[model samples]
Target: MATLMLQGTGSDVGKSVLVAGLCRALSNRGLRVMPFKPQNMSNNAAVTSDGGEIGRAQALQAIAARVELHSDMNPVLLKPQADRQSQLIVHGKVRGILGSSNFREARRNLLPQVMESYYRLSKQCDIVMVEGAGSPAEINLREGDIANMGFARVANVPVVLVGDIDRGGVIAAIAGTKMVIDSADSAMIHGFIINKFRGDPALFEDGYQSIEQISGWRGYGIVPWLSDAVRLPSEDAVILEKPVSSAKKRQIIACPILPRIANFDDLDPLKLEPEVELVMVPPGTPIPAEAALIILPGSKATIADMSAIRDQGWDIDMLSHHRRGGAIWGICGGYQMLGRTISDPHGIEGPIRDIAGLGLLDIATELAPLKELKAVRGTAFDEVLEGYEMHVGITSGADCKRPFALLQRQRPEGAISADGLVIGTYCHGFLGSTALRRAMLQRLRINSDGRDYVASVDAALDNIASELERYVDIDGLLRIAAGAGQ
Candidate 1:
């Protein structure tokens, strides 16, 4: 099978999006294609069809390729907790927790596992598109690096380096990478692609040529900034720092940005609504009282994020908002924080202890060692909604009797307060369902335009694929994938 890996000059260089767009584009060309990432470090995760979890970006790429979600797509996922430690997931199962120092050593040992997944995928597909994490230029990290060049070298995969021109220094980022890396590693990269270019492409014609001349790598193409990307779920928390909606929107939906926010892209659909304004309230910024709904998103560390909210006075703000009859909705860890008490005897997150929750709901939760990962279908507000559950807590109390939704598993999930103003669920992506979105807007007395969010995402993927056809050198990329390129 032909294999091509896309590595970025640095993080957030549009490598993931490019890989996704290319996957869809190649699939459109009637080629059996698959996306692979040997290792990924992100809290934004998605439940796979295999009843396991993988990085959300890989999940999105699978959708783009029109394939089933598989944990083998991302064999090694590192979800950062705190204290320089991360929860390591190996082949869709939790292996254990490892600190920074130990993780470096552990990663080398996991190479065989990574290769096994890669080989399995390669055998099933005509072309396997691999995505590299961070930059391969970090010589320090190159020793035990299963993420980029190391994986490329082992798999004998051709690499195409990508640099974000919008970030500036596109020339140095590409050429510097060539200068810093070892000769063998440098030889793996056949060509380079400049991403996120704005304005006239002619302006950068000289610059692109300079990169080609300096690095002796062929110029693939330059991709312009895609506005349609907003419709797709972003996999990084760095995107949460900026405002997601315009201030002029009539209805305001505020979400407090926790320190270790996970799966914050659940708010992406809300940003698409014209009348709805979505705001991410950072630390020290109080939740707006005028907000019609305050959504508490999932967190990698519930206790620590809860403490951060208290320290920022956001807990008081949420209480005040609740008193004003504003709606409060929590997902996963946020749901745990909304309960009366949260106990972690095994210290799954941190030190063994119990902490008081917001007490908005009568329920209590105990963090467990076993995590639940499932793709679920359910009904909320009498509207059909589908989402996935990925958490490690068991909640129970009198309030659970008023479940927020009836799941497909013939059981009630989540809880609703007696006042009907508080709702908490462990499911993520519930709002992406059109029926649920409309019902939620109606509850807030806002007009619904009846948009199909799933269709919008599909259309966005098609648009990205179309753009890739126009901007990227598909023929050259295909040749590179076939191991026939310089």
Candidate 2:
């Protein structure tokens, strides 16, 4: 089938990024490669070229592979809406909301769809690099698991376990995981890869030998950490809050830390500015008043997180800043929170609750039954804004009064108050475009040097992939794909 699996020791061990690099590596070798994830759980998603929504990581991988994204690449997506409830997207469409416990039991019913998607990708690509979610040794969830060992075992695909040495316990994490996996699933593991290695590769000689001796899995390679990875657009919402320093003017920008953060790459383009620093302030941290601008980023649980905003004291800070004539901008879920009131009639976020918003803009929002998921092209802040639409609320009345951006057919989408201090939009990538980013920052009295955000990110991926290709044995991976010993 020309398919291989990339399994990780645990979550956020760099499996997704490695898969992206390998996909680019293989594609650079003149082979058509595609990225696949049997199952994924994240609220941050991407709209495909075909107008379907899939995990954001898979979308980035597809971009790295230089292939068109499709829903078949990620057939099962679980976007958590609450602690125990999630909105399930099967084969690219919403099926409904299910509690986490019920979702686990219902996952088995999607196995057929999983296999079908796998086989379809197999037929179309020269090689399909599959990403396994979390750890394969999660024995408790392994019974109903379709992401790691379960998918690998069903497809009989060889696996390369990626362990992050930077996280510490590299030896224990890799060996312990191997020791606990079922015999059949263990047999599918072709080799082990030590990723994010900081010191000399030779320094890990003993550690490499020990992993082989203990797990009986060959050591494929030891990849050093890529420092310039800032060029690659991040899809993991967890890492979106890292510090971003801009070199253009040496000023910092902060985004209001939302609890249920999603699709946070909206700030990535700003990172390209050499003089700007993008700071994602989570709850408890004080928002600096000297910052050039404050953005209220997207979120999954708007009402719940809005409550978090008030609890974290940001609501008070925002109010204090607004009176001082500071600029406040919000996108998507953040846009909903800028209104006067938000009502959850369908109880999508909570039990049909209604809450007061920041009141920056004179508007009201109501959570709706239908979700909006599609790629959108519009003009915002005097620039062409290209991004996907994903939300479950409708803003109405005087709140939706001013139009911030013109969508297809020149329809106004969001609003800008008469004072111009507060602006809100449903668009996510408004800041990615140079014209839009410049316009918005100019309105805040901030000067910026333009940057080619997308090109710089793609170039970073290319450099990282080229470096990894030089160290890893490509022929060895092909042999494993052919069901042979490396």
Task: Identify the candidate with maximal TM-score.
Answer: 1
Question: Can you write out model 1's per-residue Cα lDDT over 287-397, one digit (the tens) per residue?
Answer: 998999999999999999889889999999999999988899999999999999999999999899899999999999999999999988979989998999999999999
The models' CA-based lDDT, in order, is: 0.91, 0.83
lDDT of 2 by residue, 51-97 (tens): 67899889888998999989999999988778888888988888887
